[model samples]
Target: MVSVHVTTEVFPFDQSVDLCPDNDALNFTTIFLITFGSGPTLFSNKTPADFNFTTSHSQSFTFDVNDGMFAFVNEVPDLNNGWHGNASDYTTNDTDGYMFLVNMQGIDPQIFNYKIDDLHIGRLYEFSAYVANVVRKEKCLNKPNIRFEVRAINESGNVIAKKGTGDVPACYNMSWSKYDISFETTHSSVVLLMLSNVAEGSGNDLAIDDIELRVYSTNDLDDTSTTASSIFDCKNNDEDYCECSNDFIGLSCKIQSDDVCSKHDNNTYESLFFITFGSGSDRFYSKTASDFNFKTDLKKESWSNFKPGAYAFVNSVPSSLTVLWHDAAKDHTTNDTDGYMYLAGVGNVNDMIFNYNITNLCVGVDYEYSAYLTNVMRDIRWVSVTEPNIRFEVRAVHKKGDLIAQKSTGDIPVYQHMTWSKHGLSFVATSSSVVLLMISNVGGHPGNDLAIDDIQLRVSSANQTGFCYPG
Candidate 1:
């Protein structure tokens, strides 16, 4: 630390001293003393209380500071033109007036009789400066801005720390800019600092004040975390209520028991078959459970061994417009048709089998029916008729039992081999009603027995609904 005191018989002007430090040699803990005045500046080997002066008195003492820290004094002119300065050794003869008075504050003001020594490195240091200006002679430059800077260097005289050329602003009241200076301990080696006016040109006078320096080490702080981790769980038995959790890698599934059904992700099952019965003791049989073939006619005995008034009726419920099938007759069961519809020779050589009914149907839907005869029993003689002659013809009547459509097969001689015949008729119903299919042989011999099989009823869609199978 450096200390000083001042007393003058008369105040002269203003004065200051500078002390530069070695930042490398000092580990920590350093101090400096600084003083200011509007009059003469004193740096004698005297205490401040022992100093004497008249108009105004001041003293500034310089002390060597560490490279990380240094001490210095600065002053700015107070006027745009006039003179200002500090006096050191005053003469009783009033001859040697005073130190160089700073002419003006702006536009390249100079530092007169100022010198620095002793600087250290790698230590935290404080620095400050002051300025006073007299503008009685010339106009100050435009926009007078000023700044201070510091640097640290090694014993090799290499500079380690230096402030950039940016200027620090000064107030008219002579405010000081105080800050710490530290040298980066690595490469170069030297420590120094400076103060200067920025650009120039200003109306009012300016000054610097209360320059100081201190040195120490910097303190430490604390630390924290970066990202967040979280999880979600869903546990209700609703297919639509569960969420796709992070554990499954964002893939969703209906959880049956902690795991999902492996086949399809979110789909379940629906049943396949349904039936509604109306009339007749009809039985359905399939070689397999998945088989769709249905035998349409009632089981019967022989066709040639005619029996009177023996007939059977099949019923269907009409839900929509569809194609359906019915058996008019079946003669493969036994040797006797004890009670049956007769087939007789006619003038048209037509034999007719009457009354086939699908008694149950939806009220307004139309239906088409077809009879397929797979095996026909025959005699040896040809039918006494023209080509395409028929032994029987099947016709359908609407729910009111009125005839709507008819179909018949071409005749085959008794000596001809047997073949299956597919006979079909189409009709539309005015109301939901049951219709009877009647078979008549119009131009051929009767007594040919037939066996029928495989019947179906199907409803089809003309267009599609918007929903699709989720799979």
Candidate 2:
């Protein structure tokens, strides 16, 4: 077993076998899980998509003309002499197994990387993998050293945690050695897991298999400052099935916390106005509301000013201005189909980008107007003109009638990457009807390019009733 020194309390799993090649080494390398801290259904048996190595997305050693990086074999293959030929996989028992015949050569040290999403905040996770140093002890040039790094994907690649497998000694009769590490997650929901070969020179080759990662039990979370056992309140101390605390409502108390995860709860709110548009269609926006923009795309119109509803679904944005512009990132929706975003270059007037009128709302009830916007342009200097300024507004009757409530996203500064920010406002429905509008706060300038998405007007879940549109 690899001894890991993390901040959290980690109980060690002993592998008492000596590093020297010996008989009965097969059993020492293959215990997949100890099943200790977590319940019976502790680890997720299947491989996570983020960390998995597949044929199409091969993330491994540099492709050698002789050995060609890696291959799927039952055991260590014979390259030259039979030093590593004795290594056999003990985890997968089948004709086609999990063992990887890896060859590390050339300059690139990175083995592979994976993406993780929707991790529970402050929850403990155990990551483990099996590997066998392929080099013979006497002829070992460089002992295989592996490094694991976790970086937040959305936070402009900020590192959260890291660990290293100390120089793996040569051979368990050329058998496998297990490596494990435990980490607690922070607020970052999306992360990248990268495995890199720390050692340079030859004899750094290894056979790796049975890579696994899953959530395990923790006495407490960093954020909540309370034990998961107490928050879950499992019946009869059954941790698997339990009752959630406060606003948490999910199986095993593993849903998103922070009270507002259920803001769009299917039973709580009815989508009164879901902002959607057509393929540069001028008829659609004006058809819904006469006061909306007469046109969608502004490429044909003047840059001095823009009309209300003069918005277009600007889903695609070139990552760089040079050769890779064709491979721009699509809209923010995570579906199999292509989704579009409201892309706009706000002109001098800080134009009224959108307007929608809905009728017969339940008076005295609550409603929320929300939209996500991101600045598509960047600036080397901190010029405020390059940033995007968006406003979400709610009003009674017509577009310019009595204002109900409003909120403006001051100046959305340029981030290292395209990071979307959500802006919203809540109001009590004084009248039976209201108009929702999206206005630009910044006039035409150097950097007012914006991408907007997921615009919605929803009634409070608790106040949502069928009578909201009752005849």
Candidate 3:
């Protein structure tokens, strides 16, 4: 070894210059490792039906068939100690189909694995599914959580992308909620998706259904058709750096922005008046004046031609009453057979269908109010029937003449399939309270029938006055 020389002499260079400047040219980078392509085909569920994949990391699984049960989609889960929800698989709502149950105890937690072959290099994909906790208790002791991993199979197998599903809390009564994770592929045309358990204790029991792999972005970080070994440093803490539009967030920028008040974000929606009508195991529960906040009264009859301001809380639409109407067995929100909806039989024009005064409003704050409504008149009608049109309005509760905002569901036409469309508007509250109104713009006996559900008012977290919208 040569002797080291500690030179005390000053270098013959300018002292004000930066000696150890950040040389970005020679910095260790991995952004160029993947060649991002433009115009990738957006797709869903690349794997076979219900994740039936032949290839996996290992061929062994400890799924106990004894604890695994099967139940029909539209029936109650009473046979399996009510482990699953009353309404099972979200996608296949067939009454004859069954959902396969899973057991908690197993040797290895890595129960599911699927290999995705057709992938555009440097493209982003998101895997999502509906998960439910079956513990039936307040605190989750053995709740099932999932860990997702995206592995590049055809390359060096160096990619290790992962995401975790935190403890899926119980809703006491059976409930189904969705969870998702995003990942980008690099260099490899084939990626192996591995789903494993990452729970702490035993009883990792869960009900899973409707697995899908959808494209979040066509390219990686807006770079198309250019890749190097180690070009620019374009990541921070293993997350891809993206210039996301304001409505999107997260590393991959795949998640839509939301708040505690919104349900479209798949988070627990908190609203001032959370009107679900009523809920039960698998029964249609009736309501009183308190349920509607003492605004309107229910009709003695649920059929057509009752009167103005008369309503019925029904779960299933009896098609025998109106042959031209659509028969919907499930509610719009819960998709449960026993979930109730407000079936309105309009009598006169401009009649108030439902009205309630929402109190304790935050001044100068934005809020979104909406109601799900479906026109009962079938699209295949022989006669020229007038479609139902409802006007939603919000007025200052103290000052009745001061109108805050108004919007109308202009001509709700019936589709071949039963569909519920949301009708409402966003407003900035100028007063402490507002009278929320739902009125029929045009009404008659045979043409103005409609069903309503999930009326709510929540804080508006997204605004179009910013960079997010007009993107």
Candidate 4:
């Protein structure tokens, strides 16, 4: 048995080395060099073949080429302006004679396997190879794509570290290129290197040559002090303690910055008028009256209503026969917290209308008005008689009743029962003073009933630009 000391060295096999006994035996573990090509003494073998060798460390390495999948060619085939025509295409020494030409797809695909012993744990190793795509002028069908993978496995057969050049696409009429991949090993025992053609069946063809691997120690890495200084370096104009780049915010530069709405935050928004219709004075529904007459005065519980300067109305009346306003926990589930109640009614001859007037809004500024709605099947028998469609519309009007903008939640098929859905319209205020938000049911069917809650009108920021009347 021969003992070989494996040290960090570069290997370029320019001299004669072969697996055959007639030629000099390649003691890979000792010589640290190997090449796949014929010398002046041997005739070039064009057929696909396998070269197998054993390392001094007793690890087996096999370079297998499938029958019709690959060939040892001396020059790139004349096509596509001779993409890889240069003799020194992908070789470092520039004295290239033979290279592995792979036809990405065939009855059997091209593959190579090599086992390495005693890799340093936690150390980073870089594997690189020169490769070129053989371009064909005819149709240019299936182009070649290749991958070089390295896996560090333990005795238990579990992969501890894995890395690869995922896929390299064919470079048409381009020079041979070098690709490198780096990985840190978790296990120290062995490393398996595999080179494979990953392109799909047929046309994709490429050539590969001069594969190399190098190990890097931790001390060889970039200076850590430079990285630390850049992270903590504060700029004079920045409000945060650390001047973080790449959209990183916060004192420690830990938070990723997001698109901020000028007039609104994640939890709250700038609202001219808002109502949740929850408990207490905020409740917008009444049991005694058939409709809310905001023309007289503002109701104690209502936020916006019909008045001398502004007007609002709702054709809603409490009924004992149907399920109306109740805590979300009582019979329905709402998006809001406890005590969130809702108002509901069915479409009839006089459509169920909910309208309010908002005043003192900023002109030319966009605002979003939204409300939650849920299908309520108070009477299941009505569902069979009426059309299965429900439509709702919301419009923004000026104080003098001129239309600003209008949007509709188009015919939504009744599927989810009692599930709260949100419908909203964004509009820009044409007048700075008063705006009327009117929500009404346009689908006038007997059973088209829906619950409405959490009406809100807020200033729109960010990409919340409202849509205007399309000409």
lDDT of each model, Cα atoms only? 0.27, 0.47, 0.48, 0.39
TM-score of each: 0.24, 0.38, 0.41, 0.35
Rank by TM-score, descending? 3, 2, 4, 1
Candidate 3 lDDT over residue span 396-450, tens digit each: 9874447675545545665667787666656667777678887765544456788
For residue 69, what is the lDDT in candidate 2? Answer: 56
Residue 101 of model 4: what lDDT? 60
TM-score of 1: 0.24
lDDT of 1 at 296: 22
Per-candidate total of colliding backbone pairs: 87, 5, 0, 7
Best by TM-score: 3
Clashing pairs in 4: 142-204, 143-204, 144-204, 294-306, 306-311, 306-312, 307-310
Question: Please, what are the lDDT tens digits per residue for candidate 1 over residues 1-471?
Answer: 112112123232222221223223233343332343323332223433321111111232433211121111222222222323221211223332222122123222332111233433333344433333322212222212222333223344333222211122212222222222233223222223433332223322333333334444542111000000111232223324312231111011222322221211221321111112122233222122112222222222233332322222222111121111113333221233321211212223223333333433433332334333432333221221121222221123443343333333322222233333444332333333344333423222233233332222221111212112333
lDDT of 3 at 139: 32
Q: Estimate, for each residue in 1-471, the C-alpha lDDT of model 2 and write its tens digit.
A: 121111111223334522212222222222123211211221112232322333222333222213225544555555556346635654542333445555665322455454555567766554566667776544524455555555556646644544445445553256466655445666435343434333244566776665545554442323211111101121233333212222111221222222222333233457766554333323112232232332332332222333322344444664433221223555555452445666676673346666667788877765666766776665332222334555555678855576665445545655546777666655667778777776654454555667777776666544456136665
Q: What does the lDDT come to for candidate 4?
A: 0.39
Model 1 weakest 10-residue run by lDDT: 221-230
Better of 1 and 4 by lDDT: 4
